[model samples]
Structures are given as C-alpha cells and as structure tokens.
Target: MQENEVITDRDNVLFEAGIKLGALYHQFTGSPVNLDTVDSLEKGIQESISVQPCVEKISVSINRDMISSKLNGKYGYCELEGRMLDVHITAIFKTAKVDVSLAFDTELDYPLMKIEKIY
Candidate 1:
C-alpha cells in the first residue's frame, strides 16, 4: 500500500476472516477425537477462536458420520480432518461485519473457506 493508502473496515474484516480460518484449520487438524469427545472439541475450538479480535461469533460442527467411518479398527479415534469441519464465523470491524465459512465442497473435494456476506 502507498503511504496515503487507507484500509477500510471491510478490507480488514475480510482479511481477518481468512486468517481465522487458516489458523483454526492448522491448529486443530490432526488432533485425536472419538464420538464421545467430539462435542467438547467443537466447543473448545469455538471458545478459543472467539477470543481473537474481530471474531464476533463462531460455530463449529464435525461430521459425526464421517468421523465414525474414518476411525481405524485398532484405534477408536480418528484424527480431525479439514473435510470434517463445518465452521462459520462472524467478524466485525467498526461498522463492517462479515460472515465466513469453512466447509467441505463435494465438487472440489476439499474444505473451502469463503466469505458468505458482508455488510
């Protein structure tokens, strides 16, 4: 940016949303989890991310069916995968608010993070 450039709240929020999704995915993926601990894991992730700046709200959901199918015979738990997470976050900077999500896109076969809305 040039010296006179000004960053708007909308820009800040959009950037922050990407940062939040990236951090959450990297920090939590590969953690061990079973059906019994899934709920707690979701809550833990949400609470942890909620403390960050501009994070107004967050929701995390792990696909229980996917978890069950992916569990190995020897171990009753599976490592968390990006494909298993369905996350939504609302972030606000000043008057600008943005909603974003991380979810599995069947067409893309990956966890896709995208801006849902901005206002």
Candidate 2:
C-alpha cells in the first residue's frame, strides 16, 4: 500500500478504536455516554492530529499490552468495589511521527437509597 493509503487506514483504525473505548467507558461506568458524545470527542482528537505541527510525523506501532482495571466506589446503601475488567491489545502502525495513543478509564457503581422516615 502507498504511504498515504497506509496512513489513512491507520488513522481510521485509531478513530474507531477511540470510539469503541468511549462506548466501553460508558458501559463500564453504567452511564449514558452515547454515539453523539463519542463523535464530538473524536472530532477534536482528529483535528488535533492534523493541525498540531510536529516533526517525524509518520505513524506508530503497539504490541503486547496488558491492561488491568479496578473499580472502587460508594454504592450509597453500601460501598461496591471490584475489578471491572482486564484486557490486552496489540496495535501496530508506522512510526517516526506523532502517534496519538488514546487511553480511557471509567468507574461504575450503582447505589440503593434507604428510607429515613415512612410517609
């Protein structure tokens, strides 16, 4: 593939991955962050990639990554805490330039309220 083509493909992958991660963040957080929010955030990120002047603007490659996630928060009625998930992602791309590595983290917890007085 031509260098430009490769760059395009890699950028697409990165953008998609960012969106996926944003969705996962909402899921893990038990929140309502949707496609609109993801799209908005991603646009800013992409723009930054293009506008920011930098040297050796090539690509990047990642591999053998291990992710360990832990969650701890108050659930109102009771404190809820535990390991939410763990993942290992292997990403590969061109190097020598500004390669944006997007990392996201989220904490999720559900709370139950107790009645103080009977009505």
Candidate 3:
C-alpha cells in the first residue's frame, strides 16, 4: 500500500481476516490433540479468534480421520498440523464483510488460505 493511497473497507476486512487466519494457523499448529479433545480444540480456536477486532465469526474443524490415523498406541495423540485443519472466517470492517478460509487442498498437497468472497 502506498503511503497516501486510500484503504477501503473491503481491504480492511480482508486484512483483518488474513490476520485471524494466520494467527489460528501459527498459534495452534504444533499443539497436541487426540480424538477425545478435538471438539474442545475447535471451539477454543473459534472463541479465541472471535475476540479479535472486525471478526464477525470464525469456524474451525480438525480432521478426525487424520487424528485417528496418527493416534499413538502409547501416548494416543498427535500434533495439530495445517493439513489437518479446515477453517473459515468472516470479518466485517465498516460496511464491508469478507469471507476467507484455510483448508487442505488435496491436489496441491498443501493447506491453502484463500479469500472466498467480498461484499
């Protein structure tokens, strides 16, 4: 952004949504999780992100199959990873609201963060 250029509401909404997604991915990716605790983890992430400015709402879902496949026979948990998360967020800044998401893209073999819609 140029120093004197205007920042629109859509731009602010997208920026806030991006910050939320980045925070969610980086802050929780290495945390320990098991099938039994997945629900709490999801809710925890949602609640934490919801408190940020301009965040209208947020959703977080962790892949249970992925968790199950990686549950240890002894320890019985796996570290949360970007590939195991399916997340979406809506942020409103002034009159603009934007939808954004972070999810595993199987074809690309990566977790992709994208802007889904703007209005």
Candidate 4:
C-alpha cells in the first residue's frame, strides 16, 4: 500500500508537469512569430515552468520546417499551406521528467496546431 501511494504521487507529479508544459506551449505559440518570438517563447516557458514546485529544470526546442499541409478544410474553409514549427519541451521534475511536443502552423493567424507527449 505504501509503495502504491509513492507510485501514485510520482505519477501525479509527472502529469501535472505535462499539463503545465502543454499550457505554456499554447500560451506562447498562440500568435504569429519569427526567430525573436521563438526565443522569447522558449525563455518564457522555461522560466515559468522552473518556478513550479515540482519542476527542477526545463528545456524547450523549436523546429522550423516549411511544408504543405492541410488546415481546417472540414468546414469548407481551406487555409494555404505554410511553415510549420514543432516545439518540444522537456520538464525535469523533482521525482520524474516528461517531454511534450507540439506543432504550430504559422500560416494561420492563431498558432498551436497540435500537442502530444513524447514520453
């Protein structure tokens, strides 16, 4: 019983960290951007996450790739294909660590295309 409680506590910590990272990604990527914006976003997320009690360290990686991809075609509103940025965040918690990756389509007025957990 004691061991199970410990495991649950660790799991909770990881889950909370993941959620915080996801929210940070959404907040930072919800706008149009350039290299400078990306830099600021990374710094902002790291600083914000580091202040969390469970977080010990945080790292953010941004990948810039230009590709043609479908966007919001379901409602007969099609968007032009453009550059897509992949943002990866790694949060090291006191008891665990998590990696969250998200995609942002720069063509759209609002970024933040998708988000997922890497591990």
Question: Which structure among the candidates has the greatest lDDT?
Answer: 1
- The total of clashing pairs for model 4 equals 0
lDDT digits (tens) for residues 6-103 of candidate 3: 98888888888999999999999999999889999999988988899998878899999999999889998999999999998989999999989999
lDDT of each: 0.94, 0.29, 0.92, 0.50
Question: Model 2: how far is 73 from its true place, Å?
Answer: 12
Cα displacement (Å) at residue 99, model 1: 0.3
Q: In order, what is each prediction's RMSD in angstroms?
A: 1.8, 18.9, 2.0, 8.4
**Could you estimate the TM-score for every candidate?**
0.94, 0.27, 0.93, 0.48
- Kindly give the stretch of ten consecutive residues in candidate 4 with the minimal lDDT sum: 64-73
Report the Cα lDDT for residue 81, model 1.
Answer: 98
Model 2 Cα lDDT, one tens digit per residue, 1-119: 64554455456445543443343334333322232243343344333333332311222111111111111133212111112222222222343211323232333332211111111
Q: Which candidate leads the pack in TM-score?
A: 1
lDDT of 1 by residue, 1-119 (tens): 65977989889999998999999999999989999999999999989999998999999999999999998889789999999999999999887999999999999998999999997
The TM-score, computed over Cα atoms with residue i paired to residue i, of candidate 4 is 0.48
